[model samples]
Target: MQDKTNNQESSLTRRDFIKTAAIGAGAAAIVSMSLTEGQSQTQPAEAPKTQPSATPLKLEDVLKKAREKLYPRCRVCPECDGRACSGEVPGMGGIGSGKSFHNNYDSLAKIQLKMKTFHDVKKPDTSITLWGHKLAVPILSAATGGVTYNMGLKGKMTDEEYIDALLGGCIKAGTIGMAADGIGDPLDIYEIRLKAVAKYNGKAIATIKPKTQEEIIKRIRMIEKAGGLAFAVDIDSAGRAARALPGQTVEPKTMKQLKELAQCTKLPFIIKGIMTVEEAEMAVECGAAGIVVSNHGGRVLDHTPGSADVLAPIADKVKGKIVIFVDGGIRYGADVLKMLALGADAVLVGRPLLRGAVGGGQDGVALLINKMKNELVDSMVLTGTADVKKVKRDILIV
Candidate 1:
C-alpha cells in the first residue's frame, strides 16, 4: 500500500510541474506581444519650433510699415519759416502777427496749459450732449477744406468717400464730424457729406461761408434738409486766404446776420473761429449752441496764439452758455487730454485725418482714429479715470 501511494504522489507532482510550465510559456508569449505593440504605438518627442507666419505684428509695427510705404516726408517746412522768437522781433516770423505760419508747438503749449489749469483741479467731463446726441468724447473732426486737394491718392477717392471715412471712422470713434462747405458749390458738397453722415448714422456740423446772409439762410436750410444736426459759419475764413490759394470772398456777416441765419435753422448753430472771450460771448448771445474757439486752425491768421493757449480764457468766459470746442495741433490722446483739462468741452482733429486719408484711404483713416482713441483710453487709465467724463485737470502734471 505504501508503494502504491508513493507512485500516485509522484504522478501528481509530475502533472503539476507540466501544468506550471505550460502557463509560464503562455504568459511569456503575451508579454512579448504587449512589448511589440507598445514599441509600434510609441512616438519620438521633438523639440518645438516657431513658425514665422504664426507671429503677430504689433499695431505700432504695422503703422510704421504703412507710414513708410505710403507717406513721404513733408517737404514744406512751414513751421520753421513762421516761428517767431518772443521779445526778439515785432511782426517777425512768429505766430500771432498774421505774418507767420501755424506752429504746432505753440498750439501744444497752450493746450497743455489749459489742460493742466482747468483739468488739473476740476473733474473733466469728456462726455458731451450736443444737439440731443450723446457723444463719447468731445473731440470732433472739425470741418476742414482742401483735404482732397491737400491729401488724396491722386484723387483716387471721391468727396463722398472722404466724408464717409471721416464720419464712419472719426465719428464712430466717439467724436462728431463737421463738414466744411464753400470748397465748391454749397449744394453738391453738402449733399455728399449729408449722405455719408446718414450712411454712418453719425452727427455732422455743416459749415457754410456764404457771400450774403440770404445765402447763409439758404445753405443752412439745405444742410438741415440733408440731415445735418448742426450748422457752423466759418466766420474766420470769410475773407481770408492761405499763402497762395485764392482768398475766399464771403462778406463779413454782422452779429445780426449771424443771428438771422441761426434763426433760419432749427438745428444747433456753431460759430467756428472764436479766439476771444468777447467773441465767445457774442456767439452765445447770437444763439450759438456751440462755439469753436479756433483761429481757423491757424490757417486764416498764421501768427495767432495756438488755439490751445486761448481755450482756457474762452472756456472760463463761456462755460455755461455754449459748448466750447477747440482745434489745432491735436496729434495724440495727450493733446485731447490737454484740451479737455483746459476747459474745452471737446477738441477737433484736422491734418491727421488728411494724413491718414492720404496714406490709406478709409482703412488709413480708421487706423488713425483707432490709434487716437486707444491713446485717449490709455491716458485715462494711467490717470486712474475710468469714465471719459472723469478726465480732469489733476490728471496732468503740467
Candidate 2:
C-alpha cells in the first residue's frame, strides 16, 4: 500500500483509499454540536454559510455527495442500522458483534406512532428552551470526532474543517452543535476543537472523555474560556480504556468525583452515558444539570439495550430533575417526536449529520437537520400535538 501511494494519489481520493483499506481489512459495510452561560452582554457571532452558492441545496444531493466522500467508511446506507458495518470499529460500526447498535435501530423501529388528524392542530411548535437558550428545534448535533482515522478522511478533510462545518451548519439552522474530545486527541488538538466551539460564540457544547478529575477540570476551564454553554463527560467512554491510546487514561467516575466535576464548572455540567433508572437517579444526585442517555452510539459495548428502550424508564425515574437528551437511531422528525413522547426533553442526532459534513459541508448538515424539523412538524400535526415541549405519551403506541 505504501509503495502504491504515489501511483494511487494520481487517480484516487482519500475516500477511495478508505474503501481499499476496508476491503483489505475485511468489512461488509461501514457507516456512519451549542452554547454558553454567564459572562458577556455582547451580541453573538454570525454563523458562516453552508456554501457560497446561492442555489438551494437539496437533502438528496447532500446524501449523494456524502455517499461519494464517505464510501466504505460509511455506506450512507438507507437504514443506517449498523448491520452493514457491524464490526468496523475504529472506523464506523460498533464494538464486537454490533448488537447494541442494531438494537438501537430496532427499538426505535418498533415504536408505532398514532396519527390523529381530526383535531385542529395545523402548526406544531418545534422550538425548545434548554437551560435558558431557546432553539429552533429540539434536535442538536451529537458530539463526534476522529474524522481522520475513525471516518478515514485524513487526506480529504481536517478535524477543523469537519467541526467547522458541523457547528457552523447547526448554528445556521438556529440550533447548536457539539465539539468532541477523541480519546487519542492531545490537548493541542482539543484546543483546536474548542476554537470551533468558540467560533460559534457559546452556541456549542464541548464533550470530554472520562479522564481523571484533574483532566476533566482542566478541559472544563478551557471550555469556559471558549464561551461554551455547557460541558459533558461521556462516562461511557470509560469502557474504551483498553482501546485508548498510550498516555491517555479513562476511568469511571464515582459520585464524589462527579460532584467535583459538576461544581467545577458554572456552566451546566452534563453526565452522558446513563442507561438505567438507577444511574439516572444518581446523576440527579450528583448535581448534574443534564444527562444524555446514550451508550456511546453503541460503539463502546455489545448486546446493550437501545437508548430508546432504556430512555422511558430512566425518564420515569428522573425526568423532571435533570434535562434529558437521548441519542441512538433518531433518523427522522417523527423519531424526534417519539422520543419526546418517551419522556426526553430533547434528542441528539449522530451519524446522519456526519454524513452531511463529509458529503456536502455546512449546507448539507443544515439541509438534513431542517428536513428532520419539517418532518417533526408533519408528525406533530398528524398527531394533534401542538407543541414539541409537551408531546403526549398517547401519540406513540410503543
Backbone clashes for every candidate come to 13, 15
What TM-score does model 2 achieve against the real structure?
Answer: 0.87
Q: How far is 301's C-alpha from truth in model 2 (Å)?
A: 0.7
Q: Give each model a TM-score.
A: 0.69, 0.87
Root-mean-square deviation of every model: 26.6, 8.6
Q: Tens digits of per-residue lDDT for model 2 on 1-398? A: 88697786667755455465444434323222121211111112233432243345655566666666676678777678998778888878888999998999888999999989899998677788887887889889999888877898878888899999899878866789888999989898899889998888888999999998888888999999999999989999998677667778999889999999888779999888989999999999999999999888889989999999999889888978999999998999989999999999989999999998876677667777777887888889999999988888888998
lDDT of 1 at 7: 87
Alpha-carbon shift of residue 256 in model 1 (angstroms):
0.8
lDDT at 62 for candidate 1? 30
lDDT of 1: 0.59
* lDDT of the structure predicted as candidate 2: 0.83
